[model samples]
Target: MFNFLKKKELHEDGTFDESGVDAGDFVDQKPLDEKESEIYTDLSIHPEWHLPEEEVYVYRFLNQELPPLQPNQVSVYGVEIKEKDGGLIVDAFVRNSLSKGIQMKPAAIIILDKQGETVARQPFDLSAVGTIPGKSSRPWTFLFPPSSIRDSEKEIPAQGWRLALELKKKPTKHSLDLSDHWKESLPQEEAQRLHQLVDSMKPPKAGEVNFFGLDARQADNGDLHVTLLIRNGSEQGLTLRQLPLRFEDRSEEVVAEGGFKLKSLTVNMNTSKPWTFIFPAESLKKTGFGFVEMEGLSSTEVMEI
Candidate 1:
């Protein structure tokens, strides 16, 4: 009775198909082409591991370079620029090559507009990490807010601009001050806590001990517990005798600090060691402290057993 009112169905290719079903619909489609398979395979890899975007513009800058004055003393590994919070953040990784430590005091980044005129000269007070150890690299980040650069006489050209790092040279043979440079900036109690933490661990050597996957939070008892995933890059097993750590605020002020001994001293090579430090309730103020800024391995030796 109502069968005559049913609408006809059409296949994707646009022909009415009144049969129960067509042979094409039952048959399996052909396997994807070689090129199509490759596309699916490429999507599996993480995008972060891919190369930096390559877009053409007016300005050109080198990502990495060796300073002419003391090529043997230090080298800039790379520079990365990121936009955050309506500002530009510049991160520079610098390495020390000399056996002696190198200081980056009077450190500043000079931004130049077209025609090579200085647009803004922002100085960095890396008091937190005043000196970098020999054979090690550390990151220095500088932020440029939109309001900070809006007053510039010359705007950043579409062609791009230059970012030059100007640093003063200070060569000291392992005599650089390792104490909490954040002393003046942090609260008295916080500064004292940091000073105590750094005192326990010795300065870390590059390629010796590196930190990753750090986590920190307050415990039920009001103490601050910090955990770090540390990797031993050396060939021998490491028995940490002294490990010091510090937490700093955005202003480079120390907030919480502490360290602990490993129950099992010897950590195997190419293995990750989980270390936790606990700061007493009174170590930090009532308010929440900021992120981890500074940490180091004070004294350690190769374990034979």
Candidate 2:
């Protein structure tokens, strides 16, 4: 039984390969010389033996930035309006002709009277529509409630009513790898460790964001539910990934801490959008946690303000 575990094999250079080596073989084997030892040591540090998962991820976000919104990037096409249920329903198609992806907000339609005076300004929200990929088009619909089209002293013009559409520019795409096991591909906790390390560095300046109209309450499932409005007040759109959120009580102690993400998208310029953040069950330890404030973080560098 012991003899079966041993083998006598050697390379032409008189070195024993591990595949056929036994404990007793090492007694007569020659030790590797200085030159051969250095060669083997250098091969151990080859990149193929290690993964650059964290460095790849860190450099990805560090270099990923949204391009500026160019003129005529997004345009409204094939719009048709009809009256239904005492309201006006708009059937419209939007096309993104650029080579970059875009997320569209609601387009505005300005109704003008026969004399070119403004009659009613209606917002045609398009949140239900899917994202328009680069050099692609998508369809969306909007309805103007009857009450929204009424004027104090006049009805909608029968023949001279004109509609002007305003298509707001959307933010360009910023790529991030979302592959499965992306957060776990690295070894020795390097992924999380490097993420925190790079996140602490100075961030590049982009668009400005502000929060307002906060509403927080407890849901039926015992989770804390929050809804707030955010506005991008900068001249250009921004790719926003996370928002810093906290709940505090009258004593100024923290109760629950969390952040929000845009989930592979960005906000439009000068656009106000609503976001909802939910804290899981039993997250709040204090019943007096009544005050809440929210802040935004830069997507490219994870810097929070």
Tell me each candidate's TM-score. Answer: 0.27, 0.28
> Residue pairs in steric clash, candidate 1?
58-159, 59-159, 59-160, 201-298, 202-298
By TM-score, how accurate is candidate 2?
Answer: 0.28
How far off is residue 183 in model 2, in Å? Answer: 62
Clashes of 1: 5
Query: 33-140 in candidate 1: lDDT tens per residue?
Result: 222110100001112223334311100122112222122333332244445675566544444433344554444556555466655566655434455554344544
The superposed Cα distance between candidate 2 and the true structure at residue 126, in angstroms, equals 2.5
Error of 2 at 117 (Å): 3.5
Candidate 2 C-alpha error for residue 18, in Å: 76
How many clashing pairs per prediction, in order? Answer: 5, 0
Q: Against the true structure, candidate 2 has what lDDT?
A: 0.45
Q: Which 10 consecutive residues of model 1 have the lowest summed lDDT?
A: 37-46
The C-alpha stretches of model 1 lying farther than 4 A from their native spots are 1-69, 72-78, 150-160, 166-305
